[model samples]
Target: MGEPKIRRLDGRFDDPEIETAFMRDSWAGIRVQAALTLIGFSLAWIVSTATDLMYMQDSPYFLPTLSARLLAGSVGLLGGAWVLMARPGSDSRDLPLIVYGWILMSTLTAVIVASVFPTAEATPDGVADVLVFTSSWMSLHVLAIGVALAAFPWGIAFMSIAYMITYLILAVVWNEQSEHPMIAQSVVVVACCFFAWLMAITFSMRARRRFYITRLYEQAKIAAEKAQEFSSFLLAATGHDIRQPIYALDLNASMLEELVDAEQWDKVKPLVQRQKLVASNVASMLSSVLELSYLDNAKRPVTPTTCDAGRLLRDSVSGLKDVALSRGMALHCEPCSARIQVDSGVAGHILSNLISNAITHSKGSRLLVGARRAGQFIDLVVADNGAGMGDRDLFLESRSALARINGGQPLRSGMGMEIMFRLAERGDLALRITSRPGHGVMACLRCPRV
Candidate 1:
């Protein structure tokens, strides 16, 4: 979170995987540099040989220059071959190897140049010509190598410093060249190398920052997909495992209704009815869970058709009548004949959750469920007249209650509200809730009138 934990000296990421990812991103550039190294140095060696044969055949420095060029060219070929063949992997160390190879080749090239400078005074034009040639070579070498070392800021710095040190040593050894003093030359070369180091740092940092953001985005996408997959799996397993028992209980309840004797029926009928009511409530709760899961995944499809809003309201209320009765509350449905254009199944589920939530959490003795025509839309309403709730209580979800529950507080019973809200949203229906503490609570679902 704070500057991303990079190493102070080498700029390597503290996390090895992160470092490896950066290296992988740099691999293509490294390979290209290797290829250029092989081709560029081969041409340089041939040119130098030809130039010596044409102009400097009798010069004392000709053999030494030819030998140095040959040795440096051979080293460059070998190092370039190794770099070209190397592939980045899980190891964060692979990138450093490429950088070190470049450094070694650059150092060898510097040694070849440095060896010629000490004896520049012996040339026909004295040290001036040698000074001009060395300056041009150093400038061109630094600029070319810097471009080839793209995406590796630290490597560029190291190579530049190595070359500078080689030049400085040569300058010290050739102090006899008084006309164009070696000390002044060393200072200019050092400044150029240092400036290149700074530029390389800026370029590499920007590249690493981009790679970091991309990696984070990919990781987040994968995590989200896996979470959705896990949610779907859990929903499927829960529906199967829980529905089997509920289904068996339903079958047993039907069998009991048929097989019981008339004498025992009077007493047993109530128990069977209670069992059915409990089973129905469980099934309804399960349906709510499934609906919520579907909505979370954005996979629930809504098909709007002409539906009797009145019948839906009555059916939802009727299913939860026992729950209301058990809680010593009276459930009522107002008369209505409104029709609406909405997905019947989705609307039914929303109505059921609304009615069930009121039955369980309204804490009121009187509950009302009804629907009425309101211009272009039919509005289904569930209102409770018991001890009302606050706006916060109306919207508080079950998950948010976990912290309170852990602190020895009662968990809020608003999971149903959350589910109903999502279901209504998916069906393109409007849901609204109004609650006032100690007054009452009312919820409305608005649908297109048919």
Candidate 2:
């Protein structure tokens, strides 16, 4: 009815499933990146240590440079261990891990630059070389963050700003001895920050889009499978249910032919009636199946009207009276003056289906239809004192009855109950069915009272 809410690529979503999935997927990649970072830092530390010992051991910045590299490598090792050991399914921890790695990487870069820069011999050419070296070193960390850890745009912005602030603070502390100009260093920091932010947004948006496409594809595949199953169930159920009635009709036709040849006029009337009854049953079954199918697939709107509950109950029973009588069952209705607000047609169909099902399957001598008044509602009940169904049978009936229409397992004789259930749902009525072994089955449809 309205525009769907847009999901911002902030690593949090309104839907918990999407949020959990995004975090889980990102964590997988994050773990691999963490391992790679650990290796890279370790290799860098080893190479830098060897270079310092062989060539730059006499330099004033040598100890600080070596110390900074060791610190960075240690941080990388700790981060990698933590990320790898933590469960990827722990969605709440992934963001913290990314932020933690970014902080360590950024702070270490600032420490190394600040400690070594102030002690360097200042020269025009030397300043340019130093800036180039620092920028190149910083860019690696920036790229690692951008490519490895999938972060929210705001998180990237925060890490970038925090790094710049830390660098500026360190630069201010040693401003006098610093060889590089503040503006040049600031420019480099800003550029790296902007790049990281841009990458974060771009990667997040792409991930969300991919997730949506994958989700839709999965849903479509499931629906296709369900449709195929439903088709197979339909064919099997229709064949099994329709065959009995058609066979009865054929047997009646043969008997009628025999009776006519003998000129048995008295039995002819009842035999023809029996044939019509069998044909009627076939038609009813087909109609119920078609209606149930339509109800399952289509959105049918219900228009409620005030109706006399007693009259509605009586009418439903009266229509099915002949069918019940044919099976030697007595159908009775108790009087109730309660008026209910409901979709009368749907309600009537639901009642008739319930009555028919009881008459056909209950194998009982008596069926009762009645209305009872409750506070603000009236319960239209159709109960049968038949051989009764056990708890398992009732459970199966309730489960497979309507679920079968929607591609679930089919019950051989559940169409009538399925029709009743579907109509009750469409009409927004609460239908409850309860049964006990040797105590028969009772169905109650609760409707709003006028």
Q: How well does candidate 2 score on lDDT at residue 193?
A: 71
Per-residue lDDT over 134-168 for candidate 2, one digit per residue giving the tens place of the 0 to 100 score? 55566566656665554445656666676666556
| Candidate 2's TM-score | 0.65
> Candidates' TM-scores?
0.52, 0.65
Candidate 2, backbone clash total: 0
**lDDT tens string, model 1, 6-77?**
654444677887777787776677566655665575457645667556545576877766766666666566
Q: Which ten residues in a row have the lowest lDDT in candidate 1?
A: 394-403
Model 1, 136: alpha-carbon shift in Å?
Answer: 3.3
TM-score of 1: 0.52
Candidate 1 local Cα displacement, residue 252, angstroms: 4.6
Error of model 1, residue 400, in angstroms: 36
- Residue 199 CA error for candidate 2 (Å)? 1.3
Q: Whole-model Cα lDDT per candidate? A: 0.65, 0.65
